[model samples]
Target: MLKYLMLVVVFVGSSWVHPMHVSVCEINFNQKDHSLEFTHHIFIDDLEKSFRQSFNKPYLDINNPDVGKTTDELVAAYMKKHFKVTVNGKSALPKYLGHEVENDAIYTYMELDGVKTLSSIRIFNDVLTEVYDDQVNLVHVEIGEDISSMKLTPQRKIDELKF
Candidate 1:
């Protein structure tokens, strides 16, 4: 009995036990408009889990059409708090442009205008890290011809993308 229990524990602790918890964020610096556009893609299931923890609603479902406005507000508030970016020591408050559900993922859009230059960019993406231990947030930044990417984890919440 003890051997069987130990085997089960070992199997559960393996890589197969880890769930796929990841979010992707794409940022493009529009030279013509002199602004930055942000798009975040997150899995619906992972987002629902995080929302449930934040709102203390165990059965919360963000995909439900009946709770449209409420869910939008929740999502906006959460994104505002968890995901952030600053360029050249100046913080850009993302203008929430709402979100869309495409297949199994929810894609949120935001843009920050009046960004004239970027010597350095600091990204702080905590997304669903608060809810999942192995959560990974991938950030991709594009500036003219130069493009860079970084991985943000719970331990490393912030990262810089240099041109």
Candidate 2:
């Protein structure tokens, strides 16, 4: 079901004003590198709407360059505010590497270093929930050889998994 949903969202996410308000996040712990990887998939239109509404700016163009920041930087800041990850009860701040724009959606990448072990993982993702009441964020966490998934909505923004 998750794979089917992901396929649908990726194929049709470029269109403007879709009924579904959703985002996808993938977290992986790299044992060799001792780091945590985060990848977020979000619609371009919905992200722009979030920026405009949150910043109170009428004309915020994510595709075009702004004097304040590049599109990826702007998005990274937003993600830093809306998305959080806690490992073993300690919160981590990830470094935003960059983003990729495909069709009507953008894929953002972030990484946290020096995370050698993981006993418990908690994710708080409220991306675009303020703009859309029905917003849903799907999170997939990978630790060692196991993968765990969770669905986040406006009413519930956080989920925890124990290793």
Highest-TM-score candidate: 2
RMSD of each: 9.5, 2.4
- Pairing residues by index, what is the TM-score of model 2? 0.88
Task: Kindly give the stretch of ten consecutive residues in candidate 2 with the minimal lDDT sum.
Answer: 9-18
lDDT of 2 by residue, 1-163 (tens): 5555764755475374477878888898998999999988888888999888877888777888454788977888899999998888998889999999988888999999998888888899999998999998998887776778899999999999988
Please identify model 2 stretches exceeding 4 Å from their true place. Answer: 1-17, 65-67
Give the distance in Å from residue 3's predicted Cα in candidate 1 to where it truly belongs: 46
Candidate 1 per-residue lDDT over residues 1-163, each given as its tens digit: 4333532443344325435577878788998898899988887878888877766676777866244457678788989999988888878788989899876678899998988877788999999998888988888787876668888999999998766
lDDT of 2: 0.85
Error in Å for residue 109 of model 2: 0.3
Taken over the whole model, the C-alpha lDDT of each candidate is 0.79, 0.85
